[model samples]
Target chain A: MAKSNKPIVWSLFAGGGMIAAFVLPAMIFITGLAVPMGLLLENALAYDRMLALVGNPIGKLVLFGVIFLSLWHAAHRLRMTLHDLGIRSGRVAMLACYGVAGLASIAAAVVLLSI
Target chain B: MGEVMDRRPYVREMPKSWWLGQRRYTFYMVRELTCLFIGAYALVILVGLFRLSQGPVAYGAFVDALQGPFAIAFHLLALVFALFHTVTWFGLTPKAMPLRLGEKTVPGTAIIVAHYAVWFVVSATLLLVARA
Candidate 1:
């Protein structure tokens, strides 16, 4: 069998896509709409409470995972999508798309850690 | 020379707006665009993390901005895009792995149902965690 590292990254993209599909919509609804729209109380996201949430090690891990995986998923997906659009430059598209994901993953880590 | 070149079967390259013409092609384009929404969504969360690290003052403002009309509108649009992403992704899962059950291949409908079931569980977990 000819082994390829592509599987590893593809696995990440698949997992990330699953996580994003399952979790992100609700998260957006709650934080972006429900809480903000006053369907939920204001202090539902009070500064201290949110700080405490991010302060938790588990919380940090989940946040970081969500950010990292989702970005990588989008990066790989966009790379393939460009090909579908006949970009005709796989190497450059791969580098550009994955490069942003790599940098953003680092940034997400740094920010999550600092919190 | 011109006549000879013109005589050759001209392969028309796909137009940039080629997706707009067909329902299937438009859906494909929408699916691709949803990837960007997911990317943008991740950026939004990362920004929240950065703001939190900066301290309560910055984080408060981020939450404030999220409440604002523009942010709400963006998220509302994002919600639609995210749902599109979810459905399309799960729809393809069976093809991606083609799961088997004993001697029989698992049905794609079963795969999608399993995905939704797990999805509900995770969503419940997140809700519980938030409440806790």
Candidate 2:
């Protein structure tokens, strides 16, 4: 029998799920609601502060992990969700879902590095 | 051998709309659909990051765009979906990784509580640190 690559995808899915569960709510609340609505400091996400955050090596790593893993996790889940919705073309679904995620991950890496 | 050959196994076909018939199934679908919002929110952040890399003006424009009515609405919905994902994920943690303490399995409730505790601490830290 051929080796299955399910584990690799599943690991990323699980890790991403963990991050999404533990950290994403606060992130969304902060960036989406609080900052935009003036609930937090006036310049919580100002360009200079944000640039500084992304400029730091540790910040870059953290942002990369969150963006990369979350994308993979969502990709895998979306693939399954598509299947559940009766799109039975497995190969096509897999390619489309994972393809977007792969491209986005590369984009994230590049953008982070350039910063 | 002849009788065995004549017997066909029964196979039940699941209707595509099966999930719609039950509340639990619908909830499950909603839970799965959280990925859409999560994926979208990730892309939004990615765009913001890209803009930040471009320059201050570009990043400032991106931030300005986020405050518009449509952007605010999208984020509001995304926030709801994200919170839903968090709640469901924490609920399933115990089943995914049961704790065993020297052959005695820890109660699932305890495991769930621990997850919530960690989640709260992490969230508070992020909010506070980001605010500073």
Best candidate, DockQ: 2
> Against the hidden reference, what TM-scores do the models get?
0.87, 0.95
Over B30-127, each residue of candidate 2 has an lDDT whose tens digit, in order, gives: 99999998999899999999999999889889888888989889899998999899989989989999999998999999998998999999999988
Worst 10 residues of 1 chain A by lDDT: A38-47
Runs off by more than 4 Å, candidate 2: B1-10
For candidate 2, the TM-score is 0.95
Q: Mind listing the fnat for each candidate?
A: 0.69, 0.81
Model 1: pairs clashing at backbone N, Cα or C within 3 Å: none
Model 1: per-residue lDDT, tens digit, B12-129? Answer: 8778778888999999889887888799889988888788788888988988899789998999999999999988988998898788879999888998999989988987776665
Candidate 2 per-residue lDDT, tens place, A17-83, comes to: 9998888888888888888888855678988899889999999999999999989999999999999
C-alpha lDDT of candidate 2 relative to the true structure: 0.92
lDDT of 1: 0.85
* N/CA/C clash count, model 2: 0
lDDT, candidate 1, at B73:
91
Ten residues in a row with the worst lDDT in model 2 chain B? B1-10
Error of 1 at B120 (Å): 1.3
What is the per-residue lDDT of model 1 for residues A14-98, given as tens digits with 9 covering 90 to 100?
Answer: 8889889999988877777877887745566777887887789998898889989999999999999898887978899999999
